[model samples]
Target: MFKVIAVAGSPRREGNSATLLKAALAGATAAGAQAEVVYLNDLSFRGCQGCQPCTADDTCRVQDELTPVLGRLRQADVWLLGAPIYFDGVSGQMKLFFDRLHHLTNEAGQLRKMLPGRRAAAIVVTYEDKPRDDYREVAQRLANYLGWMGRFDPVEVVSLGRLGPSDAAAARPELLAEARALGQRLVEQLAQQGRTDG
Candidate 1:
């Protein structure tokens, strides 16, 4: 079975980003992939301290709750990252988790592309304002970063907007459907590339 990691970066346990991420995981599971959801809020960890300990050993030296999670990333076939928008970018939790991914680089100070072979990734962002072309840039930025890590395909970056404060994304069937489609599409891409080695 293919392994997928769905990361939810929203502080709210049941917020829009989390709901959408769950929907994507559901789709991935239905497609016969082993999918797991990781909530950054639930993990007790600090951001990358810039000490670059990973440069020497390719591992984060802080050794908090995220250490095991980082280990899982190396084995996952796909990554689905979802976060809420804060100040026109991903939430602080998401940014910090991403920063820690420096461990994916080699000692030569170049990206090691953590996961093996031709991998896949998806990025989802939820915003309170209306959807704008530029709003997708945040997701695109992460996608580009992942691409540089050797997952060169264009990531299935998704942007959701105008979600009400108390409205779980389930109320927005369209968005939920889109999230599902994105998940299924990601799996299809992986299968096409024959990277379902798990």
Candidate 2:
């Protein structure tokens, strides 16, 4: 069975980002994929130390709660990342996590481990009524980074805006449905690729 990991970067467990992530995981599970969710706020971890140890060994030197998460990400067939927009970008939790992903590449800027044909989806939530392109750009940049570092192709970005309240997303059934459908579609696409390869 395909393995999928959903990382929630919001401090609020039931916040918009986390809710969407849970919905996505539910859809992935229903689609016959092994799905797991990681709440970054629940874990105690530090940002990248700039030690550059990964440049030599292709592995992060600072080991913490995020160590296991990095391992799981390496093994998963699909990655679903969800975070709220903060100051025109992803939350601090998500940014720290992204920094830790420096281990994915080497000094030469080459991927330390190639995960070809993998898939990824980024869910970005914003409170601003007029969701600026900056938010979408940030999400798209994340998708592009994953594509370059992990060989994840066709990364999808689901941007939700005007969610001022924590429960705002819950009120929008359409948004949740969209997230679920994206999850299912990703798994189905991977399954199809596996069949075609076999």
Which ten-residue region of model 2 has the weakest summed lDDT?
A: 108-117
Q: How far is candidate 2 from the true structure (C-alpha RMSD, Å)?
A: 2.2
Clashes of each: 0, 0
Error of 1 at 79 (Å): 0.4
Candidate 2: residue 55 lDDT (0-100): 74
TM-score of each: 0.92, 0.91
- lDDT agreement with native, every candidate: 0.82, 0.80
Tens digits of per-residue lDDT, candidate 2, 20-55, equal 888888888889999999999999999999887687
Write down the lDDT that model 2 would get. 0.80
TM-score, cand. 1? 0.92
